[model samples]
Target: MTIRPIVRYPDPRLVLPAQPVTVFDYALRALAADLLETIHAAPGIGITAPHIGVSLRVVVLDLDPVEGARTYVNPEIIWASPEMILHREGSVSMPGVNDEVSRHARVRISYQDVDGNLQTEESEGLRAVCHQHEIDQLNGVFWIKRLSRLKRERLIKRFEKMSRN
Candidate 1:
C-alpha cells in the first residue's frame, strides 16, 4: 500500500466529475489500496479517488476500526431521506477547516466492490453523512458547495489563512 498525495482545495480537478471505473483489475485494486493508505495518512474518515487526482468513481471509508475499511467503486445514491440533519463536514483536500452542512439523515447507495461485484448499503447518522460527502466528491460537488454562500466564503477564508501559516 502507498499513500498518495492529496489534491488541495480549489483545485479544478476537485470539481470535475470522476469517471466510473470501467475495469476492475489489478490497477483498480492498487488504486483502492493507495486510497486507503492515503486516507489513513490523511487521518480522515473517508476519501474519494478524485481527492488524489484520480478521476475514478472510487471511495474509501473507515468509520469503524472493527468494521475495517471499505472500498466502493462507481457508487451512486439510490435513495435519500427527506429528513435532514446538520453535521460537521470537512474534506481531505481542505484540511484545518470545517463547517456544519445539512445532509440527508439516511441514504441507500448502490455500488460495486473493488472486484466489480454489485452491492448496496443503507446507512444513517455518521455513515450516512460520509456516504453523501464522498459521493458528492465523486460527482464534482465539493463539500463547501453545500454550504450557504456566506458560510462558504467564510470557510474559504479560514482555509486560505490556515494554508498560509
Candidate 2:
C-alpha cells in the first residue's frame, strides 16, 4: 500500500461529485488498501476516495483506536437522529484549521465491504460525526460547507492567503 497525496481545498475536484463504484475488482481493492494505509499514515480518523482524486464513493475510517481499519464502499447514511452535536472537525486536505460543525449525533450507514458484502452499522458520538463528514466528502461536500456563510467566506480567505505563501 502506498501513501496517496490528498487534494486540498479550492481544488475543483473537491467540489466535483464522485462516481459510484460499479465494478469491485482487484484494482479497487488495492485502492482501498492504499486508502487505509494513507489514513493510518496520516494518523487520521477518516478519509474519502475523492481526497486522493479517485472520485469514487469509498471511505476509510478508523475510529476504533485499537482495531485495525474499516473500509466503506458506496457508503450512505440511511438514517440520522434529530439530535445534533458539535464537533471540532479538521481535514487532511484542509490542514491546520479546525471548525466546529453541527452534525447528527447518531447515524445508520449502509455500505459494501472490501469483499463485496453489504454492511450496515449504527454509529454515535465522534464515530457518527466522522462517518458523516467522510460521507459528505464522497458527495463533493466539505465540513466547511456546514458552517455559516460568513465563516465559510473567512475560511476561504484564510486558505487562499495560506496557499499564496
Candidate 3:
C-alpha cells in the first residue's frame, strides 16, 4: 500500500480547484490506488485528491467496509433533496477538529470511475454528507468553510492549539 502524505489545513493547494481527469490510463489507476491507500492511512471515511496535493478531481470513500472502497473521478452533485440534515464534519487535512454542518440529506452525483467509466449515485444520510463534503473539497471549498464564521474561527483556534501541543 502506498500512502501519500496528506496536505495539512490552510495550505493554498487545499483551496485550489482540482483539475479533472481527462486521461483514463494506468497512471490514473495508480493515482486512484494511491488515494485509497492514503485515505485508509488517514483513517477517514472520505478523502479527495486535493487532500494529498494531487490537484485532481478524485475522491475515495470507505464509508462501508462490507461494500469496500469506491473511487470517484471528477465527481459532481447533479441534484440534491430539499431536506437538510446537520452532520458533524471534519477533514483529513484538518484533523482533530470538527463541527456540525448543514447539508442536503440526499444527493445525486454524476462521476467517473477509476477506469473513466461514467456513473451516477444517489445517497442519503452519512453517505450523502460525505458526497457533498468531498465534492466541496474538490471545488476548493474546505469543510470548515461550511461552518459559520464564528465557528470556523473557533475551530481553527482549537486546531492551532492542538498542533502546538
Candidate 4:
C-alpha cells in the first residue's frame, strides 16, 4: 500500500464529516494498511481516514508498538466519564503545536475492527485521549478547537509563521 498524502490543517476537506464504512472488503483492508503506513510515516499515534482526504469513518492507532497497529472503522464514542482530565492534544495535520486540553479520563467506544466485526472497548489516560482526538477528527473537528480562543489564535499565528519559513 502507498503512503497516502495527509490533508493539512485549514483544508476544507479536513473539516467535513466522514461517511460511515458500509462495505467491508479488500479495499477497506488496503485503506487501513495504507493508513497504518501513513500514520507511522507521519509519526503520529493515531490517524483517521479523513486525515488522508478519505471521507470514511475509519481510524488507525498504535499508541504502543508492542500492541501493534489498531484499526477502528466506523468508530463512535458510546460513553464518556464525567470526571475530566487534562491531556495535551495535537494533530498530525497541524503539527508543531500542542496544548493541554480537557477530556474525559475514560471512554467506552464502539467501533468495527479491521475485519468489520463489531468491537467495543474502554480506555483511559493517553489511549483514551487519542481515541477522543481521532474520533473528533472523524466528526470534522480539529484538535485545536479544544483550545481557548486566545490559544487557538496564537497557535494558528505560530503555525503561519512556521509555514512561511
Candidate 5:
C-alpha cells in the first residue's frame, strides 16, 4: 500500500518512453499495486508506471465495483476504428490539466495482465479514449501533444497558475 509520488508534467522522465515489462514476478506485481495505490490516492481514474517515474510500460485503471483495478503491462493498440470521437482526457502526472482529445471511436488492444497472461479487448467511447490516452503515456506522448497550439499554450498557462497556488 505505497502511494508513490506522481511525476508532474515537463519532467524529462515523463517524456522518456517507458520500457516494456519483461518479468511478471513479484517486483512487477508490487509495481502494479503501487500504481493502484498512487492513482487511487490521486483520485484519478487512470495512471501508468511512468507517472510514478518507474519508466515501465504498465498502467492501472480502476474499473471499480466490477473488477477493481485492471493492470495492463506492455499494452499495444492493434487496430482502431475509422470513426472518431472526443473525450476529456487528463493525466495523473499532469494534475489539474485536461482537454478534450479526439481519438478513434473504437480500438482493439493487446496487453498482458498483472500476472503476465496475454489479453485483448475491443473498446469504444470513453473506455477506448482512456486506453488510447494511457497507451500514449506509455509511448512518451504527453496528452498536451494531442492538443492544438492554442489549446496547449492555454493549458500550460493554466497548469502554471495552479502550480503557483
Candidate 6:
C-alpha cells in the first residue's frame, strides 16, 4: 500500500468529474489499498480518488470511531432522509478551516467492496455525514458548495488573509 498525495482545494482537478472504473482488476484493487493508506496517513475520515489524481468513482472512509476502515467502489447514495443534521465539517482539501454544514440525518449507500462484492449499508449521525461528504467528492463537489454563496466567499477571504500571515 502506498500513501498517495492529496490534492488541495483550487487545484482545478477537483472540479472534474471522475471516470468510472472499467477494469476491476489487480491494479484497481491496489489503488483502493493505496487510497486507504493515504487516508490513514493523513489521519482523515474519508478520501476520494480525485484527491490522489485518479479520476475514478472511488471513495474510502473510516467512519468507525474505534476500528476498521471501509472502502467503496462506485458508491452511490440510494436513499436519504429529509431530516437535516448540521455538523461541523472540514476537508483534507480545505485544510485548517471547519464550517457548519447541514446534511441528511440518515442515508443508505450501495457500493462494491474490495473483493468485488456488492454491499449496501445504512448510516446515521457522523457516519452518514462522512458518507455524504465523501460521496460529494466522488462527484467533484466540496462541502463549501453546500454553503451559501456569501458564506463561501467569506470563508475564502478568511483563508486568504490567514495565508498571508
**Model-by-model lDDT, in order?**
0.95, 0.88, 0.92, 0.91, 0.90, 0.86
lDDT of 4: 0.91
Candidate 1 lDDT, 4-66, residue by residue in tens: 999998999999999989999999999999999999999899999999999999999999989
Highest TM-score scorer = 1
TM-score of each candidate structure, all chains considered together: 0.99, 0.94, 0.98, 0.97, 0.96, 0.92
Let me know the TM-score candidate 6 reaches against the reference structure. 0.92
lDDT of 1 at 87: 98
Task: Look at candidate 6 and give me any clashing residue pairs.
Answer: none
lDDT winner, 3 or 6: 3
- Candidate 1 achieves a global lDDT of 0.95
Report the C-alpha displacement of residue 164, candidate 6, in angstroms. Answer: 4.0
Residue-wise C-alpha lDDT for candidate 2, range 1-165, written one tens digit per residue: 899998888788887778988889999899999898888887688998998989899898888867867889999999999999999998888876778999999999999987778999999999899899998888888778999999888887887787788
Task: Tell me the tens digit of each residue's lDDT in model 6 across 59-81.
Answer: 88876757687778888999999
Candidate 4 residue-wise lDDT, 93-120, digit = tens: 9888788999999999999987779999
The most accurate candidate by lDDT is: 1
RMSD values, in order shown: 0.6, 1.3, 0.7, 0.8, 1.0, 1.5
What does candidate 3's lDDT look like per residue over 1-165, in tens digits? 489999998899999999999999998888888888988888888988898889899898998879998999999999999999999999999999899999999999999988878999999999999999999999999989988899999999999999999
Candidates in descending TM-score order: 1, 3, 4, 5, 2, 6
**lDDT for residue 39 in candidate 4, whole number 0-100:** 88
lDDT, candidate 6, equals 0.86
In candidate 4, where is summed lDDT lowest over 10 consecutive residues?
A: 88-97
Whichever of 4 and 5 has more lDDT, that candidate is 4
Model 3 error, position 108 (Å): 0.3
Cand. 1 TM to true fold:
0.99
